[model samples]
Target: MTLFGGLAGVAGAAAAVRGTSSRRISPYDLLLMTAGTHKLARLMSKDAITSPLRMPFTRYRETGGPGEVMEDVRSEGSLRHAIGELVSCPFCLAVWAATAFSIGFLFAPRFTRVAASALTAIAGADYLQLLYAQLQQSAEGTS
Candidate 1:
């Protein structure tokens, strides 16, 4: 089978499993889920330090500034490889993260918010740190 077919099968299976699970996903929760997915996905798939974890499964491509582009994965013609691709892709992993968040939000709203808050807060902090460095560099260049 083609790689795209395998990827589709993995995603489909995940969705089917999620569908079978009991949960309530409201419009507002969907918004929170989207936000959470964005934050968590960034950390998991794009962070510089996460390279080691994905290195075995992915190949380093061009630099993505703080992170790097990963390719040549997910096509090893095996389920393990497909999972690796899923784990290495922010957009792909976001769906899984969002699904987990949906279940967590439904079953453990308090815990879910606390964890999401931590990650969201860290994401905010990361931007602020980058901004601070940029401003510092500008000042240094000006002087």
Candidate 2:
């Protein structure tokens, strides 16, 4: 498990560096990758930071005015809506499910935790790269 974790960390760091430097990731792709990484991290660390990453669609909700009121009324409803959408969205759900499954498999005594950890790390790296590219493009366009 330790070896796997190390490999994952290294891979994730490498991918993040490359992605940030290359500037090739799209917004949607970045979101998916971030979501996956967060999920993976949460599974491995049993931490709270992954909460925000798990539900990307919720971030789109309006925060004020009638929209806010509507959001408030429908907050639970929105969660359900988001879950349904997440389950249906191939790209988003794939990573979400993969991370969950990997975590589960890793905990089984006989399963290979290191490989799972490494896989999550690779996913995280890809996501970081995507995020980097998106940020780079946005920065360039604004400049």
Which residue pairs come into collision in candidate 2? none
Per-residue accuracy of model 1 over 61-119 as CA lDDT, tens digit each: 76675554545464565876876777678888787687568657755777887777777
Worst 10 residues of 2 by lDDT: 65-74
> In model 2, which runs have C-alpha deviations exceeding 4 angstroms?
1-111
* Per-candidate clash tally: 0, 0
> What tens digits encode model 2's per-residue C-alpha lDDT throughout 30-139?
45445555545434222233334434333333333211211111235766665635532445545545544443333331242444445556667766877998999999
Give residue 39's error in model 2 in angstroms: 10
* Clashing residue pairs, backbone N/CA/C < 3 A, model 1: none
Each prediction's TM-score against the native? 0.67, 0.28
* Best model number under lDDT: 1
lDDT of each: 0.71, 0.46
Q: Please list the Cα RMSD from the true structure of every candidate, rounded to 1 decimal place.
A: 5.6, 16.0
